[model samples]
Target: MDKTTEEKFVTLLEENQNIVHKICRLYTNNRDQHNDLFQEITIQLWRAFPKFRGDSKFSTWMYRVGLNTAITLYRKSKRTVQTQDFDAVMFRISSEEYDDTVEQQLKLMYSAVKELNDIDKALVFLYLEDKNYSEISETLGITEVNARVKMNRVKKKLKKILNP
Candidate 1:
């Protein structure tokens, strides 16, 4: 709450904001929704900053808070039964750099990812971010073994969705 703490929070948020953006991208279907989720996550993080005891890495803590915020929003939105098309260009891959085949594959993969349940989506997001099983378990409050099991299930699920 003090100036020093506020400064530290700003610095940390600036350094790790990509983590927040990635989570938002996975959870929201539009630019407006993405910005709303990002702002809400920032508010949640700021509110919880005072209680952050540093028991885990700052980035790890950010992941926990960010994912929880996203999941909560996702559940609330689902209760309203609103459905939107997946943004196929979410990754903004340039066609100049990659061939149409690769771009199409990425789009299909992202579309499949969007179809996953909230927890499964979080698992895939964390996996893509290169988080180890321990970190994924810690972030999602599951055992490492459970994380592995869920991730395997999620992968197969994505495969089925993409192929079917």
Candidate 2:
């Protein structure tokens, strides 16, 4: 936590904030839980910063840290679950551009994702991010074949949720 490292940390966070946000959205149900996850991911990334060797793309590094944090983080208490990260970062989106049915379908899909297991959620998140099977396998230390098969299963699970 020296000043120089702090500066680099800020730069790092600024460069890859979107990865954290995407992971949060896929894994959590609401603004509060998502923000908690966002803060936790930020902290995890900062702690693991010294280990980053630039051997891979920054987004790849982000996937490792963000997914690790999300899978491992647990609630300290129900009352303390909400976090301030969302308030700290301002992202603008226009919901009005979408019609009501589209919005409803989007919400339903998010709700379905929220019900999946941790590893399944990770698969769904990667697929939603448009990551290739090879990239996801590298990030998760699995074979590309396994990644594709799991993605298929996650897709079927989500489809069942939407239909049921």
Each model's lDDT comes to 0.79, 0.72
Question: How well is each residue in 25-118 modelled by candidate 2, as lDDT tens digits?
Answer: 6666566776677777776676688888988877887998888777766434432344434454333322212123434656777788878887
Per-residue lDDT of candidate 1, residues 55-147 (tens digit)? 999999999999998888788876222333334312221112212343354666777899999899999989998999999999999999999
Best by lDDT: 1
Off by over 4 Å in 2: 1-5, 74-105
TM-score of 1: 0.83
* Candidate 2 Cα deviation (angstroms), residue 163: 1.3
TM-score of each: 0.83, 0.75
**Could you tally the backbone clashes for each prediction?**
0, 0
In candidate 1, list every pair of residues with a backbone clash: none
Candidate RMSDs in order: 7.9, 5.6
Choose the strongest candidate by TM-score: 1
